[model samples]
Target: MAPPQPKAVAKPAAAPAGGVQKAKLGKPRNYDLGNGVVRFSKTKMFHKKAKYKFVGKKNPKAEKAKKPTVVVKQIGGEKNGGTRTVLLRRRRSFYPTQDKITPRPHHKTFSKHVRRIRPNLTPGTVCILLAGRHAGKRVVLVGVLPSGLLLVTGPFVFNSCPLRRVPQRYVIGTSTSVDLGDFQLPAHLDDGYFKKNKKSAKRTVKRKTGEDIFATKKEKYVPSEQRKADQKLVDEAVIKAIGKRADKKTLRGYLKAAFGLRSSQFPHRLRF
Candidate 1:
C-alpha cells in the first residue's frame, strides 16, 4: 500500500446569535445534562386570553343561548261531535314578508310508496304470518353488495332463507278486510242437530218399558205452538236490529239490509 491517506473530517453546524443551533440543520441534535433532562430556557412565553365571558351587562341576551320554541297539543272532542283536531308546528321565518304568509297545505298520502319492513325481504314488501310457527317470519334485504346478496335475517324473523322457498300464496293481499264470514258446522249432521239439540248425536234414548221406537216416531214433530214461538223470536230480532240504538249514522247498512230497507225510504241510514 502507498502512503496512508488521511480521512476528511466533517464540519460542525453553525450556532445562531442566540447561542442555540437551529433545529433546521439536519443532525442528531441533543443536549447534555449531568443526569436529568436539559431544560431549554424559552426566550418568550406564549399565552392566550380566554374568549368566554362570565358577566355580560349591555347585551346579556347575546351571551345566553336562545330559548327553543315549543308547541303544545290540545286533545278532546271538537265542535263537530267526535271530530279530532291537532296543532301542527309553525315554521319560523328569519324575516317577515310584505303580505301575511301562511304555510302551504301538506298532501302526503300513504298509498304512493311501498314500505320495506324486513331485512331479508325485498324492497317492495314482506310476507305476513297468517298461521303456524314460521308463518309470519320475515327476512330483511340489505343493500345489494358486490360480494353477494345481502340478506338481514332474524335477529328474530329477519333471518335469511333461500329465495326459492318463498311461497306465492303467502304474499300480503291488498284488500283491507279478509271476509271469512260465518263459520258453518260440518255437513254430516242434520240441520235440526244445529238447532238447539240438547242431546248428543251419538246418544240414543232407551225406553224403561222395553219398547222399540222407529226413526219416524223418534223424530220430533213441529207443532203450531213451535211455529208461533219461532215467528215471535224472528220478529223481535228484526225489530231490535233496525231500532234507534243501531243508529245508521254510526253504523253501516248491516241493520238496514237485514230489514230489507232502501236508501230512498230511510235517508238518515245513508249518512255514514
Candidate 2:
C-alpha cells in the first residue's frame, strides 16, 4: 500500500477587503449620567422611554355606543322594584345550635391536584409556594410537576390563599409566560463537567461480582445446633484418622455428662 494520504485541512474563511460585516446593530447604548458626570458618543443616542403617538385610523363604527338608561314609569310596579321602602322586621326566630344549623366548613384537599411543575406553571390553579424565598407570594399555577415539587407563577395564586394555605385552581395548559426581565438566569447550560464525567464513565471498569459492590463481606452459612453436632462427629472421625487420640464411646459419655443427662439407677445394677 502507498503511504497514507494526509487529511486535507480546512481553509479559514476570509472576509472582504472592508472587513467582516456586522449583524444588525440594535438601538444605541444608554449611559446613566450621574452627578458631575457626562458621556458623549460619536453615534446617535436613542431614547428608550421616548413616547411615540401613533396617529392611525379611528373607525367611528368601532366606537362603543352607551346604552340608554331604561326609566321605568311608576305604574305601581316601581314600589316592588325600589329598595327605599324596605324595612327590617323580626317575625319569629330562635338561637340556632349545631343540631339546628348545618355547619359547612370550606375544607379543600390537594392530593391529586397539587402537583410538580416545570418550565412554567398553568394559569388557573392557585399557588402559594410552600418553600423558597417566594413563599409568601401567591401566584397562579403555571407548571406541572412531572417528577418533583409544585410550581406557581403570576398574581392569582397569591390572592386565592389569603391565609397562606395550599395552592388550588384549574389546570390550564397554556403557553409559557416567564418574564425574562423579572427573573434572570443563564441562557445556556455549562457542559464542561458533563464532558469530564462522560470521559470518566468511558474509562470505568465494572465489578466482576455483586460482592465487590459492598465494602463488608457477605454473611456465610452457619449450621444449626443439631447440624453442628453432626459436623463435630464427622470432624472427630477425620481427626482420628490423622492419629488423634479421639474415642467415639468416650466422646458420647462426655456429651451426655455435659448435657446434664443422669440415670436414677446405675446402668450395670439395673434389672430388665
Candidate 3:
C-alpha cells in the first residue's frame, strides 16, 4: 500500500431559512372521549390513568357501634303490677338524635272525634226556639238529628213552624217531656227529608227581560202532598200525645202564644 487515505463521511443537508416544513400525517390507533355514547372511555387516548383515591358513601352498618352496650330498665303495667328488670342492648349512634315537631289533629277526623251530645237534651223534650223567623216560638223536640241538630215541629196548626230542624245550641231544653208511649216517628225522616228540592233548569234559555230578579212572584211555593202527609202524621201524633197530658189545654195555649219581654222584665230572671 502506498499512503493511508482518510474515509469520507456525508454531513446533513443545510435547512432553508425559517426551518424546513414537514408534511402533516394522521395519527393511528387514537380516539377522543365520546359524550356518553356507546362504550365510551373516560381516559384520553395514550394518556395515563388518573391516580385519585376511590371514594364511596359511608356504610350504615359500619356507622353503628361495634359492640352494643348492655342496659337495665324498669317497666310497670297493670298486668305486671311491680317493676320488672330487663336487659336492653342500647346502641350509641354517631349522629345525635333530632327532635321532630308534632302536628295538630286532622280536620277529617276532627268532626267525629269531638262528637258529644248534651245529657240534658233528649228525645220528646219541649224546647223554645231562640233564633230564626219563628224566634221566641215554643216547639217540641221529636228526636235527635244528624250533625247534633234537633228535629222539631211547631205542629203547623199552632205556630206555623211546620216540621223543622234546628241546631241544639239555638234552643233551650225545658223540663217538660212528651211521652210517646209506644209511638215513634217515621224512619224515613232525615237530614235529606228537610232539604228543599232544587228548582228544575229551563230547557230553553229565554231572552233577557226588564223584570226585577227578586220581584214578587204571582205563584207561591206550596207544600207537596207528601209534605202535607208527613206534617199531618207528625202533628196528629203530637196532638194525640198532648191530649193525654193533665194540662193539655194550658200547654197548647203556651205553645200558640209568641214570647216577648214586657217593659223592664229581664228574661234571665224568668225561668222556662
TM-score of each model, paired residue for residue: 0.13, 0.14, 0.53
Task: Summarize candidate 1's per-residue lDDT along 1-272 as a digit string, tens digits.
Answer: 79989998988877778997766656322344547654342321111222234335355455677565664445566663443444354556545558787899977665444444333334322233333344444432212222222222122312322221223334332211111123221232232422454553344555665655322234464535643454344333323332334352332232112122355676244321
What TM-score does model 3 achieve against the real structure?
Answer: 0.53
Model 3 lDDT, residue 117, Cα: 69
- On lDDT, the stronger of 1 and 3 is 3
The model with the greatest lDDT is 3
User: How many clashing residue pairs, candidate 3?
Assistant: 0
What is candidate 2's CA lDDT for residue 53? 36
- Candidate 3 wrongly placed segments (more than 4 Å): 1-114, 200-220
User: Local error of candidate 2 at 247, Å?
Assistant: 99
Whole-model Cα lDDT of every candidate shown, in order: 0.36, 0.37, 0.76
Q: Which RMSD does model 1 reach against the true structure?
A: 29.7
Candidate 3: tens digits of C-alpha lDDT, residues 16-40 = 6879856668854434446645333
Model 3 weakest lDDT span, ten residues long? 45-54
Q: For residues 1-272, what per-residue lDDT tens digits would candidate 2 score against the true structure?
A: 89999999998667678897556667534554778544653333323333233346455767689654443344347547543432244335744455665688955655445454433353333333434444444343323343233334332221322111232332222331222222221222122211222222123333786544434433444545643453344333322332322453542232122111166865345321
* lDDT score for candidate 1 against the true structure: 0.36
Flag regions of model 1 displaced more than 4 Å. Answer: 1-34, 40-64, 67-69, 73-272
